[model samples]
Target chain A: MTLLIQVQLPDGGWAYILSIIFVSLQVSVTAVGVSTLVSLPVALLVGFTDFPGKRVVTAVINTGMGFPSVVVGLVVLILLSNSGPLGGFDLAFTPQAMMISQFILATPVITSVSLSAVESVEQSVRDAAFAMGGTDADVGLVVIKEARYGIVTAILAGFGRAISEVGSILIVGGNIVFSDGQSYTRTLTTAITVEARQGRYEIGLVLGAILLLLVLGVNGLGSWLRSKGRGERSA
Target chain B: MTLSAATVSVSYGPDTVLNDVSLGVEAGEVVTVVGPSGTGKTTLLRLLGMFRRPDDGTITWNDTDVWGLSETERLAVRRRISMVFQEPSLFNAPVAQNVTYGQRVREPWRERIRKSIRNLVGDRTLSESARDALDTVGLLDKADQNALSLSGGEAQRVAFARALAVDPEIVLLDEPSSNLDPRNTAVLEDAIRRARERGVGVVVATHDMNQAERISDRVGFIYDGKLVETGPPSQIFDTPNDSRTKQFVDGELMYDVEETTNGQARKSTSVSP
Candidate 1:
C-alpha cells in the first residue's frame, strides 16, 4: 500500500505544487506593478492634453486595448530572439522576458480605461478649477484627484488581464522548471499542463484550483479598493 | 483702485454683444449695470474682469491700460480682482481649500493646514479674515462644511466669502443675488455693503432695478450693446434720459413681442404667434 501511494509520474516531483504557486505569485505581482507604474502617466497625458497627433495616439491606444496576449508574446519573442536586434540583452526564455511581454499586454488596457475614467469627471469640476486661477497642470492634478477611484479600478482591470494570461509567459519564459528543484520557475498553468500530460491528475487539479483562487482573490481586492476609495471621496 | 473701461466692445463672430461701452468705477463705490435680458450686461463684466478681450477698446485700472499687459501680467492683475458669478462655482475640494485657493504660501500645505483652519474658524485671540468674510455673508457657522453641501444661496454667499478671502481691490458681482430668495438677497446686499465699506470697488450687473437703486451709487443702463444712459442712481431711476431705459424700467419694453400698437401699454392685449 505504501509503494502504491508513492506518486508515479515524470520526474516524480512532489514539491512541484508549492514551486508552481510561488512562480505564479511572482509573475503576477511583477507584471501588475511594472505595468501600473508605466501606464499611469501615459494615461493622464492622453486623457487631458491636446497635442499634435493626439487623435492618432488615442486610436492606437484604443486598438491596443484588444490586443491578444499571444500576439504580444510573439512580438516580444521576435524582438528578443537570436536574429533580433535586442538579442544581445539575452532576455529571451527568461522570467524577465515574460514580464516584458505581460507589460506590453497590460499597459494599453490601463491607459484606455483610465482615459475613460478621467473623461467621466464632471465639466463643472474642471470649470471650477480653471476659474480659481489654476494653471493647466494644477487643473489636471485636480481632475486626477477627483477621478482617483476610477483610475484605481482601471489599474485593477489591467492587473487582472496580466495575471490571468498564460500564452505570453509560455512563449517568452519557455515554462522551464529548473532541475536544481529548490529554485525553479514554473507557473501554475505550465505546471498543470506538465502534470496532466504525465497522468498526474490530482496535482493538476490542485494547481488549477489554486489558480482559480488567485484570480478570485485579485478581483475581490480590486472591488474592495474601489469601494474604499469612493467612500473616502464622499466622506 | 479705480476701474474704468473706455469704449469697450465685444463681438462673437458677426454678432456684436457690447458696443462702445464706457463706464468708470471709483474706489469704495458700488456701480450697478441694469439692462433687459440679452443686453450684454454679463459680457461687460467679463470684459472688465479681463476674461474676454474687447473688439476695440481699453480697460484702465488706475489709469494703466490693462490690454497692454501680457497674459501672465493679466493673471497677476486678476489676483488683485475677483468675481462672484451668478451661480456659485465651488471646487470639489473641502470648504477650507476652496476658500484659500490662489493663496501663496512659503510652507508645505500640510504644515500650513493648521493656519488655514485657524483662519477659517476664527481664533479667540486674533481676528480672522476668513471668519470675518464668512460672518459678513452669514455663513460663519458653515465654514467647515463641504462647499457642495450648501444650499444654492448659501453656496453663493460662500463664493462671496471666497472672493473676499483674497482681499481683492475690486469685486465684480454678476447678478450675485439673482438666484437668492428675499432673505438671502438681503444677506447678500449687506455683504456687498460691507465689501464697499472695506474700500473694494464693486461692479454689479443686475436686472432688479429696485435692488440697483437700493445699493448703487451710480446706475448704468445697457441697451442693444450700448451704454444707453448712466448717472447717479436718483437721476437714472427718476429721470432716465433714454426712452429705451424708461421702457425697460417701467416693464413696458415689449421684449417678447416685435411691436405694440400702444407703446406705453402696461398690459398685453394679444399674442402674435
Candidate 2:
C-alpha cells in the first residue's frame, strides 16, 4: 500500500502508469473495433435467417466464447513467431500481435451476445417492414436499428472481456522493456504481472486499480444501455 | 389489378390455419373479413398480399400466378402490394422514415450503400409522396417525431400513411381499428376510403362488426378457417345464410352456440379471444 501511494505521488511513476494505460487502451480498442465489425454482421445473419447447420455453427461459437484466454494467446504466439505461418507479417510481441490475439478472443463472445440482441428485436417489426414492400435487406436493417442499444451492450461486454483478461495478451505481447525503462509492448495487465513479480507491489496495485475502474466504467455503460433499450421497448 | 387467392391452404406445424379458402378483390373494391379471433382472417389477408405462399394452392396478381413465378417476380409483385398489421409495428425512427421505407429499400444503389443510407435519407428526402400520405392520414404535423413516441391510434395512422406512400395496388389491413376509439375508427375508415379512391383494393380483417359494415363493399364471414358466408353487409348482418355466421354477428363478443346430441335444445357460451 505504501508503494502504491509512492507510485501515484511521483511524476515519473505517474508517466509510467499513463503509458501502461495508453498501451492497454490501444490494444483493447483496436481489438473490439474489429470484433464489432466482423461479429455484428455474422450475428445478424445467424440470428435473422434460416440456414443449414445453424445449430452446429451456433454451438461452435458458444464453445469459442468459453475457450481459455491462455490457449488463444499461445496459438497467436505460435502464428506470429519468426518461423511460423504468419511470421511474414513480423508482428510477434508487437501491439499488432496483441490486437490480433484480442480480436480472435473477443469476436466469438461479441457474436454470441449480439445474436441474442438481434433476436430480441420484436418479430412484428420485421413483419411490418416486409409487409411494407421492404425487401430482404430492408427487414434486416429495420431489425438492426431497433436492436441498436442492445448491440451496444454486446460491444461493451466484448470490450470488458478484451480489457480484463491478462493471460493471452501477456503471452503474445511479451511485456517488452526498452533500455530507457520505457514500455514498448507492456499493457496495464502485463505490466501489473511484471511489477508484482519484481516486488514492485506499488505499480501492481496502481495498475490493478486502473483495470478495476475501466471494468466498472464499461459495465456501467452496459447497464445504462440496457435501460435505454428497455425504455425504447416500452415507448 | 385484381388480387385473388384460389383454394388456399395454410398450416403452421401441426395446426392448419387456413383451408382451401378462395377469395378475390378487384381494383376500387373494399373487402372486409369478419370473424372471431383465430378464424384465419389475418392468414387470408397475408395470402392475398403474397406475404407467404399457400401450402396447397395458388395466388395471382393480375393474370400472373404468384406461386408459379420466380422469386424475383414474386418480389416484384410484393412491391406493388402493402400490408398494415393489427399492431402498427412502426420502425424505431421518425415517421417520415417509416413512411418512405418502401421506396428507399428498392432503390438502384448497391446493397451495402442501401443498408447504411437507409436511415440517413428517406426516398430522396422524404419525398413529396410520403408527406402527402401523412397529410391524408392527419399525421403530416408529426412527420419528424420518433415513430415509437406516438399514441396507439396515431401510430396506426402513420402505418396507414406508410401503406399509401408506396402507391400500392392492394393494401391489406389486419384489424386496423380493433383497439381504437370511435373517433380514431372514423379516421381509419376515412383512410380506407381514400385508399379505395386511389383504385387500390383494400382488404381488412376485423372482429368489429360495425367497421366491416361501414367499410366493406363485400363482407366475408370466416369461421374455423373457412369463409362460411359472404355477401353485402346488410344481408350478412340482417339475415346471414349460416347459423354460425348469425351466431358470430349476433354476439358482439366471440360465442359458441351448440345443439344437444338429441337436437332439441341449444346452448350458448361466449369465448374470450
Candidate 3:
C-alpha cells in the first residue's frame, strides 16, 4: 500500500500524462480527418448512385464496420515491416504507422454510417431541387445539406471508434517514451495497458478515466446530433 | 418562346400513362390541363417541363428538340423553366433561402462556391429576387422563418415563390391548390395570375374544374391517356366538341368499370359537388 502511494504519479509526472494525451489526440484526430475526407464521398456515391455490384460493396462496408482491430494492426505491422513492400518508409512502430492503422479502423465506420445518413434524406428534397432546374451537382449539394446533422453524427461516431481503440494503435505505436521521459508515440489506451502491466494501477486508472471522458464526449455529441436531426425532421 | 410536346408517349411496363399526347404553350399564356386523377395530366406537364423524355416523341423548346440536345444543352434549357409539384417539398431552411433556391442553383459555379463560403460565414441577407418572390406570395414578413415551421398553405405559397424566383420563361404547376382552404386557394390563384401578367407561360394540372375556369385562358381536358379535347373555357365548359369533355365539365360520373375488381371499386377521381 505504501509503494502504491509512492508511485501514484508516473515517472515524468503531469507532463508525461499531458504528452501522452496530446499524442493520442494528435494521432486519433488526424486519422479521423483523413478518414472523413475519404469516407464522406464514398458514402455519397454509394448512397445516391446505381451501379453493378453495389449491394456487394455495401455489404463489404457493413462487414468492415465490425472488423477486428487487432487484425488491422497485424496487417499494418506486416505492411510496415522491414521485409514488407512499404519498408523503405521506415514507419513501423511510429505514430504515423499508428495513424494508418486507426484510419483503416475508422473509415468503414464513417462510410457505413454516413451512407445511412445520406440515404435518409427524403426523395422530395432531390425532386424539389430538380424541379427548380438544378443540375446533378446542385441536387447532390441540396441532399447533403438536408443530411448534414446525420453526417455529423457519423463523423463523431468515427472519432469515438478511433480514439477508444487500443489494439491497433498499440501494435503500431509500441507505446514508446523518449529518454527525457517525454512520450514518443504512447497514447492514452496503450499507456493504460503499459501502466497496468507494470503494476501501476494508479496511473492506469487515470488514463482510463481520460479515455472514458473523451469517448463519452463524442457519444454525447452524437446523441445531440441525432436528436437535432429528429427535431429538424419534425419541423 | 414556345414549349411543345409532339406525339409523346410514356409507359410503365404494360400500362401506358400517356399516349400520343401533344400540347403546346407560348409565353404569356395560362394553359390549364383539367382532368380526373390518373388521366396523364401530370405526365403531360412533366413532358412540357422537360423532367422526363418521351418514349416515342420529342419535346421542342423554341423549335429545338430538347431530348436531341446534349445533356449540357438540356440543362441550359431546363434553367429557362420551373415546376411546382403538388407536394410543396420545402427545404428545412428559412423561407428566404427556400425562395431563392432556384436562383442560387442557377448562379455560375464560381459564384455558387463563393456564396456558399459566404453563407458559412453568416451572410443571411435575402436577395432582391427572393424578396420580390416572397412579396408576390404575400409572405415577405415570414422570410426569416424556417420553412418547415410554416402552415401547409404557407409552405405551398413559398413553393410557388421558389418557382417564380428563377424568372423562368415557362412554369409548370401540378395540382397547386389541391389540398388548400379557400383563402389559401385564393392567394395561390392570385399568384398564378401575377405570374401570367409577367409574360411567363404557365401550365397547371388540376382536377378542380372551377379553378381551371377561373385561371385558364385555354383549357385542355385529358382522359384515359389521351388529350380528349382542348378549347377556350367558354367553349369547353358551355359548348363542347367531345361528349367526354361535356360529361367531365358538367360533373357527370365517369368510371372505367373494368378497373373495378374483387369487390374493391375504384373511387372516382373527378371532383364532385
Estimate the TM-score of every prediction.
Answer: 0.76, 0.84, 0.91
Q: Which ranking of candidates, highest lDDT first? A: 3, 2, 1
Query: B1-273 in candidate 3: lDDT tens per residue?
Result: 999889888876776778898888989899999876777777788787776788898999988999999999999899899998888999878788899899888788899889879877988788887888899989999987789988999999999999999888999998899878899999999999998999999999888999999999999998877898988899889898998888887777354332210112222344344
Clashes of 1: 0
* Superior candidate under DockQ, 1 versus 3: 3
Q: What's model 3's overall lDDT?
A: 0.86
Candidate 2's displacement at residue A139, Å, is 1.3
> How high is the DockQ of candidate 2?
0.50
Candidate 1 CAPRI grade:
acceptable
lDDT of 2 by residue, A1-235 (tens): 3532556332345666677788899999999999999998998899988999999999998888887999999999999999999999999999999999899889999999889989998778888888887777778878888888878877987898899878998899998766665667888888888778888887688788989998898788788877876675465
lDDT of 1 by residue, B1-273 (tens): 778899988776666777899998987999999876566777788778776578898998888888798866776676677788877877655565566664522235585567657765764222276667778888777666667767888888888887887788888888888789999999999989999998989999988899999999899998767899999988888898888778777776544422111111122222123
Q: Candidate 1 on A80-156: residue-level lDDT in tens?
A: 99889899999999878887887888888888888888888765565445555555666677778677778778877
Flag clash pairs in model 3: none
lDDT score at residue A71, model 2, on the 0-100 scale: 95
lDDT of 2: 0.83
Higher DockQ: candidate 1 or 2?
A: 2
lDDT of each: 0.76, 0.83, 0.86
Query: Compared with the real two-chain complex, what DockQ does model 1 have?
Result: 0.27
